[model samples]
Target: MATITLTVNQAIRELSDIDPTTPLLWVLRDHLGLVGTKFGCGKGLCGSCTVHLEGVAVRSCTMPLASVAGRSVTTIEGLAGEGDELHPLQESWIEQDVPQCGYCQAGQIMSAAALLNGNAKPSDDDIDTAMSGNICRCGTYQRIRKAIRAAAEKGGAA
Candidate 1:
């Protein structure tokens, strides 16, 4: 076991004496008190545990903490604007009524953010391809797509 320090939400977080093979999802949620990244499946199939590792969205459940020693991690809580303002994507989410159960929305948003970071104006197929891994049991996909477009229109994640 070794101490790992990582940049999370623009702040340096030191994790003390953790197992090297521990999943980054647990490290974020259980160790660092960052529960915004949920655990839907222990496997990497579901996107519920998505987080940005140096601006690229990754499935935290399958990612070892040792792989993220010096990388910057961005969770749902980090998406908010400074000083309590909501991200444009988040605002668009509420405006488009994207969440039903709300359990999967955070991962959905994070995935969308990664998509937007790469392609600001993604087509329907693009959105579909990017968000395919993020499953929402409530079936709010149409709203999720709509919200992504709305956020892009307003210069979000661009």
Candidate 2:
């Protein structure tokens, strides 16, 4: 066990007597009260617990809290641009009606945001490669893809 301070959503959060081995997902959801990063599979196979570590998407379920002590973390709740200003992917999501169960949408968007941060114009193959880890039980893959493309076209991340 260790006392650690993590930078989350642009805020400094000090956690006392925390287990460093604890997965980041539980820390964010249970400790930090950032529940938008859902818990689907504890094995990290499902991307439901995906979040950004230094702007790169990672599986929060398997990531140790100790790994993020000095680094910054961004959950789905922090994806918005500014007050009441949604990220381009968020706007496209609403415009495209992408969510069905909505359980995996946050993770999907986080992963897509990472992808878009690297590739402004992601090919279909790029989208598939990037989103292969995220599983949407509601079968909203098509809509997700469309929304991603739309966000890209609108210069969401770039």
Candidate 3:
């Protein structure tokens, strides 16, 4: 057990006496009580537990808590801007009606955020390449792509 300190949603968090090797997904959901990051497969193949580590999208299920010590982690709940105004991606998602079951949307949005951050104007192939790892069971691929493009046009990540 080690005490790990990390920035979560712009706030510094000191995690005490936690198993170092424990997956960050479990730590976020169980310990920190941030349930927005879903659990699809415990394996790294699924993107359901995706989160941003210093603005890069990563699978939380495969990340060790110790590895994130002193790093900045952002979950879906923290992605939205304060007050009633939503993140541009979230707005585009709603405008595009991008979710079916909504389980995978958070991860999808996070991945899109990373993509748009790097490339504000991404082509379809670019989106496909970046989002290939995030599986949406709702089969909302077309809508997802459209929403991402819309977010880019709206300067979602910019």
Alpha-carbon lDDT of model 3: 0.91
For candidate 1, report its TM-score. 0.97
Clashing residue pairs, backbone N/CA/C < 3 A, model 2: none
The clash tally of candidate 3 reads 0
* Candidates' C-alpha lDDT: 0.92, 0.94, 0.91
Considering lDDT, which of the candidate structures 1 and 3 is the better prediction for this target?
1
How do the predictions measure up, each by TM-score?
0.97, 0.98, 0.97
Q: Write one digit per residue (lDDT tens) for candidate 2, span 40-142.
A: 9899998999999999999999999999998899988999977899999999999999999899999999999999999999999999999999999999999
Residues 130-153, candidate 1: write the lDDT tens digits. 999999888999999999999999
Q: Model 1, stretches more than 4 Å misplaced? A: none
- Lowest summed lDDT window (length 10), candidate 2: 149-158
* Candidate 2 residue spans exceeding 4 A from truth: none
Q: Quote the positional error of residue 1 for candidate 3 in Å.
A: 0.8
